[model samples]
Target chain A: MLRVKSPQDLGAGLLFIFIGCVGLYFGKDLTYGSARAMGPGFFPIWLSWIINFMGAVCLVRSVTLEGDPIATIPIRPILWVSVGVLLFGYLIEHVRLELALLTLAVVATQSRRQTDLTQKIVAGFAILFGIAIIATRVQTFAFLKPFGDAVFGVSQWICLALFAIYALLTWGERDARQTVILSVCMSIAAVTIFVVLLGQAMPTYTADYIAPVFSKIGSIFSSIRGR
Target chain B: MDFNVFSNLMTGFVAAGTFQNIGFAMLGCMVGTLIGVLPGIGPIPTLAMLLPITFGLDPLSSLIMMAGIYYGAQYGGSTTSILVNMPGESSSVVTCIDGHQMARRGRAGSALAIAALGSFFAGCVGTIFIAGFGPPLASFAQKFNSPDYFSLMVLGLVTAVILAQGSVLKAVTVIIIGLLFGLVGTDVNSGATRYTFGISSLWDGIDFLPMVIGMFGLVEIIRNLEQESIERNPISTKLRDLWPNRQELKEASPSVLRGTALGSLLGILPGGGAVLAAFAAYTVEKKVVRNPSFAFGKGAIQGVAGPEAANNAAAQTSFIPLLTLGLPSNPIMAIMMGAMMIQGIQPGSAVMTSNPDLFWGLVASMWIGNLMLVIINLPLIGMWVKLLQVPYRLLYPAIIMFCCIGVYSSNSEPSQLLIMVFFAAFGYILMRFGCEPAPMVLGFILGPLMEENLRRSMVLSRGDPMIFMQRPISATLLALTACVVLLIVLPSFRKTREVAFQE
Candidate 1:
């Protein structure tokens, strides 16, 4: 009786049959005009019949034939990654969207393995938090005007230098260091080309729409270089 | 219907006759053949890429090039099947046995020559059918209301499932999944989102590029990756013969003729994809051919000649449903309709009367383009055969990277890459489970059409249940559908009855 061993077939067929019947019922509510002889419900009602019939055939075939044994389903990685995406969705309003997305990507990639769950989370958080700080300082200087700009600029340079050295030190152990580095480089390159060559203002992450730290830093660099 | 059509069609001939148009057709053939020879890539993306480039050209000229790519891909698929055991598309799989076996015996050259010859002959015959019969067919099409069209789509869906080589139930389920996937986007009439789950990007609906790239390009890469090796088996060194001898031709001729006829009929059916046509043709040929000395999986010359011709003929015939009814039978044709929309050309029955030049020109160009492919593919078979000699280790990485690029470029969205990765893994599991992807593809193509028709029929009938049985055409189709199901189930019923009586 097990020869027709397609569980996927059975599940899908039953689902269709159910949905088709629902569509058929919903279609019944509409008053189809006689202009075409068949009304709106005619199609779905007929389709549902076909679906039900097909489903029955499948069910019968599955019961009558000796099909291959069902195998175990893979659930962990798909679910874990889905959860990470949900978390990213939740964090987008508070954290920068790019940072949130990056964190999601990192955590999802890491969660594929069983042992690295804790370590992956710690690394993910550290990266997200670190980027958040840079964006915050960038937001601060732009909002506070001229006096705050110079102060933030000096601090950002020092912080950037420190982070670069720290990143270099950590680059040896993590394969994701490459992705992070590429991400940083690509973001900087795109921002630079857009602001300088294209003459567009960078959109700020802060509520007040303060210019991004990179733009202020670029302006400062330009003024200093002009001197 | 008017004298203007004659002038317009003549204008179409002029448009197609130019050096520029001819060059475009030739270029499309060359490009199409190369991509077709590569396993895993198909015509849609290649044609989509060419679509934008056609913006500057006359509409007829651009369409001719696209037609060239469409049929060129069909002919190109056989080349890969002949030399390597791999087929770029599901339909081409039938060609692999004899084609590669012919290659193994150092007659790869002859196998290829015959395939190309059969394809060219069928393409010519099919083109004649399209040219002479297209208008009459298009006129005859007006009597079809939405319900009848919908019923026909149901018939197509049933044909896909029953004819497919897997469990019939699985085919139905896979088709339903495809329909659900189609329903994942925005609701056109209600403006109510169906299944986007609040993702704004999905508000427009499931993108065709991602679905196609995921199911086709990604799945193939994953399957290839799972294999320990995907190298071409070694062939004999002599490899001198290039033409089919009398005995070979004698065996292949009937199969080719039979395949052409089957493909012509099946190709016109909605949801009847090229792969389905090929498989159907192979089954018919197997049933009819006496002695059929070569088993299906072994080197059978009939296997190569029939399916190749059938698939190409079917690929051409598929255009009839799309051009006449504005219904795209497959995703590739759907993309073509998108291209037509981009050009502000409506694809429905109005197109025939409104733009005879464009319509007739496109039809005529299909014949010309097929001829171009034959002339183009024959000499280049030697070049393609040399490509099979490349090592698999070198080839797999390059193929995988190309797959990644192809998936990425289809929509310029990295999300598709992710989908591809997931589907690739899923595809491997499908292969392991002995589930064929061909039926799934056919279902995917037909699902939405089936739903649309069913809805249209019910709507037209004013909620009356008996509309399907009342219409002669619809009744005939439904009865035929019932007959097919009964034919499949009757033997099982008898067997069960015997068992019950024995007890």
Candidate 2:
């Protein structure tokens, strides 16, 4: 490892010098301009020579430096991630986006939490079933559009419950409740700001639909108290 | 040239000074910060997402908000780079070297403060330069012909290659690959498809959103998952004491100055963007700094300060080439040019003659935006520092979800997601193999522009090729290019290589 610097420097510098010279040589096909004016081939041709000179300087410097000759760090994880990303380019189209993404996340992740057989099965089913339900039955949230294109009013208690359950079950963790809370609050805030405060005309929603949903939520709480 | 332009601009500010514009600027800043804080999404996509909303506002207000987002995003980019080792864009890569290290060593607060302060200073300088020098610069640019632009673009491409780390062959190859990828959309002259491979959707070429998010963001997510939790170094709770000491400040001040100058200059070049400015600044600092113990890669303070300032300065100055010459140096500026057209204001020399208020209003608004940024970032440094302490397990999912949502919202196509994922995997591999993704990114950006200019120059010269050197500006640029080549080529010129190789 200690002797690596000299070789690396020399190697990089020599390579640059070589390439720069190639550029310079090719630049000969270009016309040289006076210091005041340039010709057609002037820039590329001259730039090549400059690159070659810099590379030579770098190569010479490497000779005198004391560098380690061994690999600096393990490279396996990096390789895995890079490969995973490329695979995703092919995977997302054939498979649903949610599934492809979850799979990618699980494969690359190295978590400290322990999972038994039942947990793994349950987790897998949880991810799959959760996405399926949201994609098919959930009407309030329009995430996977072309598949589940529906407009429901707040009268649908089932949709509201589903959203709550999904949020709690998925994001709810014991150690970090703050993140979950923040996500929930922030998501709601964002929706309110975008949809209600900013008055961005929803492609689907109208004033009548929103007005009733709030009233329904209020009524649900009031009814539980025997109002 | 018009002294009363300031007063006229102040009149436009009646539109700009309204509560609505203020709200938009603040909103833009907050949103820009969030987007910039993320490791992969830069301002370009963020602006694109907000593009539809701008249609409702007056042009002055909309432009102000977008400008706020531009500068705010620059500040936000530094946050993730410093806090985590994740860089939101190629420019922030330099910041990661020192910034993440500072976090590890418990000086994350100082790094954030210095980056914010340096950016504010540069932003102020840049705003003033724009207001004072914009008209003059515009006129100077009018002198350029296709040959001049061609030569300038060549300089930019070469400079990008020279400043990039790693093997020159690899850099060049990646650059060429990017160029080729950019050419995939359509043939302008012949109206023929070159490399679409018969995919009809791809006939328009690869969408920038999916490509950028996949290559940088998703790939990063994959890499993050592979590693053990990023809790290797916990941030300090007592962040109030994190300000740089006098000595550290003294060391870093000059770097900030140098970076500002370098950024200001490079930002004017065609195809030169924040990333290039940052890299060039870092390289310059690396070369000029004396007795630097840590190598360029190992947590150098100048690495953080220089690049941060450079990016901010470059962000402001990039507007120069775009507004003056009507040349879009980057995708973001191209979008801005588009926005201008939507407003019925054409970008070119005539804009200066016709719309002095619009021009000066923008320049004045930049100064105001810089002031707002400094006020917002300084007190919020501790809050940003605390954000760094969030656990990876809790954080990674949200990051992935955001990437998914951001990508999906852009095109509403499932294919884009697939493209992003593929690029993520490919990007991860390249990272593992020690490939610098900066070259690939730069290649992708410059390739199309380079081809266009080359063709333009060729057509103008009737394929003679001598037209490039016929002009003074082009000739000078070519000479410098030659000198650069000679410097790289001459083996005997490497006598002082030892100093350069010092750790």
- On TM-score, the leading prediction is 1
Give a tens-digit lDDT track for model 1, residues B42-80: 555345334433444567776887788877776777777
Whole-model alpha-carbon lDDT for candidate 1:
0.60
Off by over 4 Å in 1: A1-64, A70-227, B2-12, B18-20, B39-66, B234-240, B245-255, B269-303, B327-346, B391-460, B492-503
For candidate 1, report its TM-score: 0.67
Query: Who wins the lDDT comparison?
Result: 2
Candidates, DockQ: 0.08, 0.09
CAPRI quality level assigned to candidate 1 from its DockQ score:
incorrect
lDDT of 1 by residue, A1-227 (tens): 24546564554445556656665554565444343444433333444566677667656765665556545544444344433433343343344333433444444433333245444544555454445434444565354455433433453343344335434544664544554454455334433433333343323143123455667888999999999
Error of 1 at B289 (Å): 6.7
